[model samples]
Target: MLDATIASLSELGYSRTSTTEIVRRAGVSRGAQVHHYPTKAELVAAAITHLFHEQANDVANRLETMSDEELDTLDGIDLLWGALGGPTYRAALALAAASITDEELKPVVTKLLREFDETLVTNFGKYFNFNGEFESFWPIGLRFAFSTLSSAALYRELGLEDRAEEIVTVLKAMTSMTIKQMGKNSRQFGIQS
Candidate 1:
């Protein structure tokens, strides 16, 4: 059912998603859904958590198969996009958008979002190591990279189709170049491996 919820939320958005739609898409009896989630907010929040956990596993599997050099290239952006720019993200984005007016959902979704951001940082550590404290610019740069890609996803979600690929391309280039420069700076300062 969570899968159906993710699909429903992604496609119809939070405002339009209904329990009936989820049950119909999931092909499950309404009884089963009610047994698990008595309310729409509960169901949607659980769906968001489920999708994020699935994304984490997908990212870990991809990281395991990718060579370090491949991970360091523009392909890294592709990997991140795979994790961040999909049905799950769209669903979560919808939830986030709805949260602004959904007092009942606001706290639950907000906590989940905070946890998701921390998870992203932890996931990055599995791929790369920094010798010491990050430069002040480091976190901001990383946020810029992710947010830029997220903005691209928003473009696609909003039907601004033409700019999506173009924005992603630019983000990939900017992130790759920034990573290279950071590596160079680290080596110059004897802070790298």
Candidate 2:
């Protein structure tokens, strides 16, 4: 039910969504929703938390099961791109954009990003070495992920196929290089242990 609400947020955006719509889509009574979440903010917070946790789990599982040959050939940027450029990814973005200016929704979105970063550190950073943790890795990593997707999605939104491809190419190269350098640094520092 909450998942239904979160999924709707991508299409409806934050300011537009209401408990009435969520209950309508979820096919549940107001009493059911109220039983779970007394306020709209609480519902949105849980939905954001759910998506962040789900994506983190998905990435962690992928990282864990993958072998060396897979990681060697795998494009980490694609993993990020696939997530951010997709419908579900944009939902988080839409929520974030709305949350920034609206104090009412700030905590939910802020915590969602924190959890996302925490997941990244717990999963990907386990294989890397960094000086100030998120200060170093997130700038070259998650921030890059967000910027790259914003460009790609914007190009596609504008119907510029050629420009989008070139932008993606450059971003992918930078991402690959960062991953490679981090791997080397991780090994040098024995971060795995």
Candidate 3:
């Protein structure tokens, strides 16, 4: 049912995805949908949460299969970007836009988005270790990367698809330079691993 809701949101956008649509897509009874999710906001929230878990698991599995040499900030950004470009992310983006004017959904979406941000930070911390005080920057840096990539996706939706690679390339270069500076400062401050 949640998967059906995500599909509906991705295809129809937030305003048009009624419970009826989700039920039809899931091939489930309306009663079943109502039993699980009493409201559209609740249903969308559950769907986004489900997608978050799936994304986290996918990233973890990919990290587990990577060689040690492959574990770095740029590769991590690539992995994250891949997830961000998916249907689930598209669904979430649609809901995010609707949440702006939706009083009831605003809180729900806000809470879920905050949780997602924390999850991203935790996942990055588990898979990669920046040096010393630079480690403190991961949460901020990850959020910055997420915001930038998400904006890039919106730009793609607006028909600027050709600039996607350019945006990602510049993001990678900026991140790499920042990491290098952080490492230099860490070494200078005797904060070596």
Q: Model 2 scores what on Cα lDDT?
A: 0.69
Question: What TM-score goes with each of the models?
Answer: 0.82, 0.76, 0.89
Q: How far is candidate 2 from the true structure (C-alpha RMSD, Å)?
A: 4.7
Q: Which candidate is the best by TM-score?
A: 3
lDDT (C-alpha, whole model) for all candidates: 0.75, 0.69, 0.79
Where is model 1 poorest over a 10-residue stretch in terms of lDDT? 184-193
- Of the pair 1 and 3, which is ahead by TM-score? 3
Count of backbone collisions in candidate 1: 0
Residue pairs whose backbone atoms clash in candidate 1: none
The number of clashing residue pairs in each candidate reads 0, 0, 0
Tens-digit lDDT track of model 1 for 1-193: 8999999998999989999999999999999999999888889989888876787677777877987556553565677766666678888788888999999889988787677666665665566553344545555555676778778888877788689889988886665566566555533222223
Q: In terms of lDDT, which candidate is stronger, 1 or 2?
A: 1
* Tens digit per residue, CA lDDT, model 2, 84-130: 55557667777878888989788777877876876766676654334
In model 2, where do residues sit more than 4 Å from their true spots?
Answer: 127-142, 154-162, 175-193
Assess the local accuracy of residue 31 in candidate 3 as a C-alpha lDDT between 0 and 100: 93
Say which candidate scores most in lDDT.
Answer: 3
Worst window of 10 by summed lDDT in candidate 2: 184-193
